[model samples]
Target: MISYEEVQKHVSADDCWVIIKGRVYDVTNFIALHPGGRQAILSHAGKEVTELFSMLHPSDALENLPPEACLGLVDPNTVPAQENVLTESDLQRRAAREIMPPAQSMMLLRDFEEWAQRVLSETAWAYYRSASDEEHTFMENQDAFRRYFFRPRVLVRDMSTGSTETTFMGIETSMPVFISPAAMAKLGHPLGEVNLTRAAGDWDIVQAISSNASCSVDEIFEASSEDQPLIFQLYLNKDRSQSETLIRKVEKLGARAIMFTVDTSWDSKRTLDSRAKAPTSADASSATVATLPVNRAISGYQDRNLTWDDIAFIRKNTKLPIIVKGIQSLEDVEMCVSHGVEGVVISNHGGRQADYAPAPIDILYEIRALRPELFEKTEIMIDGGIRCGADVVKAIALGAKAVGLGRPFLYANGTHGEEGVRRVMEILHEEITNTMRNIGANTIEQLKPEMVGPAGPWVGANRPPYIKQ
Candidate 1:
């Protein structure tokens, strides 16, 4: 067995070593290959990373490491016990968690956000809440939803028989809403994407697994039932072979569809996430090490040079339906249909990629006006600033096959884990049912365009004269 002192000698970037789950690993070679960048590994080099690793990674994270990288297990008796020291922030979070209102009291999607804001760590909250630049698109996403008002047709049909069930790319889902792919769920809760998987199974809803999830795809798949329909959201790697390998693996593991995210070709400025401090280091020399923003650190491996031609590579690898997510314009939607993509998600990366990007709802409206026929050719879906069941109804009325919500579910899972996720689904189900009943629609297909319209005369009004200046 190696002593702890032996690991300390290899702390530099050129010769990094760390202990994980009581085993010594020479991670120098893996540093450059790490998806979270070299600093993410270098910051914790020469230390036992069981606690941190458990929080951010799956149990099998190190299984793929070359056998030669495993020097040996450390002497159990010589290694120091990890202390459960609580910082002031930890105490505050604990107090907030303790006083959290009962689950039954959560009446709306926004309730979970409040609870998460109270209980999550500062860094976790920052990462989930921050949008690109001034967050104009983030606010606009919600505002755009409000621009549409329901044209309720009362007493026209039996409202009590309404159902939210719908098919996504031929897969039946209990609701038209699917959990949008969000990265690093472990930052919100220990179980991470597993919580989402379990809840999705229980609620009979579709869960889109993120490429950058805290849990491994294997782990998330294991948590799901034999027939649970799951979608894999991909962030293509710079290495073509790696992406091909992943596509084949997910297909083999039973992913019903592949949603390739294209909007994040380049990282955007998220000031709030940048301002949050990186995890503190136990090493004394950490003062001299360079740190990266939370968003930039985790996204270093993304292929920024992605182009329309690359879609063929994904189509070549998997027989599953391919979805082009992050389409911001009607023209792009047309292109996706021309390329024979099965579906497209009109999204602005939840307003986290571009500051003034058009909201998904606005894009949906644009399609309705310019190229309504595209909806017939391809399955159109949308996500961004969705907080209620009415929002889902509005999008469906405007011709979206389904709708997606990212931050709401992240907040729900962060606050209460699997239970929180389930509650959010329950609330949305009730709201969607009520909204459908109110609008005189009994099925997902019954939501017609005439049932909804712009909020008022100012629906497409130009900016005020003072603001134009």
Candidate 2:
């Protein structure tokens, strides 16, 4: 039996897969008959293979060669070979009994060292969780979670249906949960973003595609259902044209909304990212995250140097409603309303940016006041530190139309890939249903701020350098 540790640990240079640039390469354990023409295992032997090419020479070199057979890893680009198409048997093997992995939840949520050790390859988890400047807000985000002391409510009925189902923007979805556009999924699974799309569709939920997604917009869309509501998250880049081009592609593909991510301006400083080394593959694309542009200016100018005016420009380019993420100020909220940008997703970019920024919930009241014209037209959402059903209920009661889940779903992706996400979704669903029944609230609208209050510290409090919305 392959332990989860063994699976992740064993994926080394020797334990490799055949891949091709700009083409699909499927290694579904159909080792008996590879569509790539060569004996399956023979295909992905060495790195930097090239020029004079034949499978046998390399295969024999690996098989019958002397004791020190490893002649160093070959560079993939140098390998001048044609890509092999995946056959039905390849699909069958791919569908065949896959190696089961261990539990998804890392010890990190509870233990810092264990979490760090678990997600060694996927560094973003560690980087995003770190603290910034004085780390006041960092401490506050965690402390906020503790404040919500889980008060067990006695129910009158035994048949309580906990619903993770909720809506985002104007569309109804299975749960408030959506795939949080995590970039470079292939880093975790061979199928990459392709695998994630399957989970989203099967579960009947929305997908908030990452600005720096590993798979191309076209590729991910091809893998997902035609009717699956897609929201394209944008990182305002230094190169405005590239962002504009990407946004247009999403609009053409029928994305329901544009989630303008004001959060990620630079590559987040993560301890794991700096440490983990990746084994290269052809089919494995980097999601072009580092090169892509994501910029944000606070002035609301949208100039040759982008400002909030760019929000209106984004709206003009596409028909989708724009939800401004990375908002912590009431001033930004009022401006979004004034600019006709549609909605606001109160977030601190999940603490990936400034470590000590305000928690989305901490500043919820100030921003909710902006949408006082009443709920229907202008919507409110938040992401960060949400772990349970009560967390979902608390956000709703505090005027969040819904919430966006990031880390938990990533945990889902890492633990069981598609199945893990489905499991986490079901757990959250039951938790939500449980929260509703316990609170005696039938509809989502019944949740009020008073029904929920800080079980912990709401950071970045006091006054700001701002105007009241």
Candidate 3:
């Protein structure tokens, strides 16, 4: 068995060398999953693997290698790319000066207070981050998870048996780390929706495309591979025909689900938006957010008069499962559940619509408790302040099946396009795996509210508030 110290050394590529004939080369990443077999990797475990690689074997032609390549000795020609790539130190020297990000995540709550005071355009900061003041509901979200706490049974049998398969809306998702929708993606990055949706395909994560995207719905769906699951987000259009057109197009695109964002009837008055005068994040491509005809022959309409009936209208137009977003109260949850809603996104519209609205996580349990019968029957997803795997764990434990990540992703999409999103997702994935391993929970379903506990100090007894269940 590899000891902790050995693993560290191997990971750091220190004290370990690769040997070929009489030479040495490092193959750290390839060590564990070496196609040449564990013995070949072990052969160079403590030395260099140069001569074996330099021999110009079938491995070098790995791109043309057959499926059987994985079952035999090292192809020698198949030397790992890490063998020739620049080392960490080499890359470090060439890297640009570190520029701290303008926005912070929930993980950096300790620095949150500092971030607020930093001089940034109010609109940028607000739209980018900033939930409402008293922000108690928002703060309580973290606390709520901390309170449930995980309960792992010792010596108990793990019935999971390594398969974390779960089905949602007739589609199979490995786990619930699906995509969250974003508005005016171009405001955050160049490729915008294109970059994000494509990367989602790489990780097998579902990407919910936004209605306000610069790229039209058709383009966004086209960007994804055949295997990816797509969910089209719906925002009520000023004209019902616009909404109708959008829904029909989304259905034609094979979207797995329909998400109707209902939290914002009136535009939110974010202090950030008002103070900063941020640029229009919405796409300039179409005057409207829906798929209606752009012909001047048609007159304009208004979304201000939307009602619950519109939900039914949108549903009637599409065959996909209908999910309502932004349900904060238990009453609303019950109302939607009774309306034959297939899913509910418990959100505060990322604190953009209503200042001081209860954070989505804070109200999640109430929603869960309100519809115990529909809990497993209907899908529940959430977004807003989802930064790390811990936040993801907290969300899942609070009953979120698939969590949507917003601002941070926008920051990434703008910061480095696809690479930035890939990096961000990678971090979240690792954190999710690490969190599960640390807490002794493997799959998303196995994650429970119990994994979280009180932060630093809360000596006082808990408040006897009304819990939905």
- Whichever of 2 and 3 has more TM-score, that candidate is 2
RMSD of 1: 4.2
Backbone clash numbers for all candidates listed: 0, 22, 25
Q: Model 1, which residues run further than 4 Å from truth?
A: 81-85, 278-290, 457-469
lDDT per residue, candidate 2, 1-469, as tens digits? 2222222332333453333222122232333322122322443333223321231122122232233323233354444455657666545434432433343443222322233225423333333334344456655654675554333344534434434466768888876656665554544444556566777788887888876565567777888886988788886655578678878888999888998877554444432332332224643374322211111111112223557778877876788888887777667776777777777887776565677777777667554444444345478777777777777777787677777777666555554567656666666676777677777665665555555554443335422212232
**What TM-score does candidate 1 reach?**
0.94
Best by lDDT: 1
* Candidate 3 ranges with C-alpha deviation above 4 Å: 1-126, 130-148, 154-165, 278-302, 367-371, 449-469
- Prediction RMSDs, each to the true structure: 4.2, 13.3, 20.1
State the C-alpha lDDT per candidate: 0.88, 0.56, 0.59
Residue range with the least summed lDDT across 10 consecutive positions in model 2? 291-300
Please write out the lDDT profile of model 1 over residues 232-251, one tens digit for every residue.
99999999899999999999
Return whichever of 1 and 2 wins on TM-score.
1
* Off by more than 4 A, model 2: 1-139, 148-164, 266-268, 275-304, 366-377, 456-469
